[model samples]
Target: MAGGLVKYRHLSRDSAHRQALLRNLVTSLVKHESIHTTWPKAKEAQRLAEKLITLAKRNNETSRRRATGILYTPHDLLPKLFGELRKRYLERPGGYTRVLRTEPKSTYDQGASAILEFVDGPKDLRFAMTAAAVARDRALGRKSNELTLKNRSKVLRYRDNGEKAFDDMVKRIGKLDLAGVNKGGADKSGEAVA
Candidate 1:
């Protein structure tokens, strides 16, 4: 009865399972701005994530609700996705996410691993936290600052893994020369006095 109508990958899972898998993958990708997954899965998740990001670019009540529906994670990333993430990608026409291939865990699996990440999403702990902060304010609809182990551990891991890179960069460059920063010598207070 069915013919030529199959448009999406099944991921070797039943309907419900596949839907859940894609949802979780996309959720993680959006929340953390990166996710390590197998090639096929990464591609599928990227498709969905890209669609959602385009939707986010609309930056409206409908888009927010729709993205919230698709990325229905407990942490409620809709606000951040619609606000910060949307703003970041507004100027770009498309290609919101990138897929970077990495070595597979083993040759037997014959599956390549890839990292799916947002093009301009946060790459450091401080900004990552800040990106999610404004959304958190509206996402939770409350004043409580409590968090779950999964989220707490996620942020902790981000901080942990990012520290090495931060330290290495500081050692390599002494300090980053952000644009608009004064190239002149610093004053006695070690501030850019121009």
Candidate 2:
């Protein structure tokens, strides 16, 4: 069994706890459109969340029943799940969710962290990041690099009038005085500069 393929991470929890945990994560994801958690839990919950979106896309009785079963607050979420999310991802085939890794929340905790999010929504991190990249390049009087160009195209691929939205975001971010932004008055050395 040492060389055998593993199916999924157990996350040191038994089956019931794991299911409930994933259900809660997915429910919160539906409610908020994004969530931050430990990387393994994000990965596992991403799987279930994607399947639930697929069910929502299907928009049939069986799929609705399954989605209801998976979500903790189905009464509150079923409408958004079956209506808004369905319309949002209708044309896309798969990959509804994304997982981006991050540093641990604090120095004392070293577990790998990640953000699990539904893409193409109002709170899309990729879209915002790509727009920032474009704005930065423009502010520097330089053309976008290959990676920036690729990300720009990718983030704009699905949304309605994505180009316009990207342009608007770029314009808005371009107007910001990034040099004046600070981390709670802390400068490079974590000393007060305000």
Q: Which candidate is the best by TM-score?
A: 2
Off by over 4 Å in 1: 1-6, 106-108, 124-194
- C-alpha lDDT of candidate 2 relative to the true structure: 0.89
TM for candidate 1 is 0.59
Query: Candidate 2 lDDT, tens digit per residue, 48-157?
Result: 99999999989999999999899999999999999999999999889999999999966797989999999999989999998988887776567989999999888878
Lowest lDDT sum, 10 consecutive residues, model 1, at 174-183
For each candidate in the order shown, give its overall lDDT on alpha carbons: 0.67, 0.89
Q: Residue-pair clashes per candidate, as listed? A: 0, 0
lDDT by residue (1-194, candidate 1, tens digit) is 75778788788999899888999999898789988889889999999998998988887778777787788683478778877788777776787777878899578986889878876445533334333542344333444255532443433442334445433543333233322222355543568654
RMSD of 1: 15.7
Can you give the TM-score per candidate against the true fold? 0.59, 0.90
lDDT of 1 at 108: 95
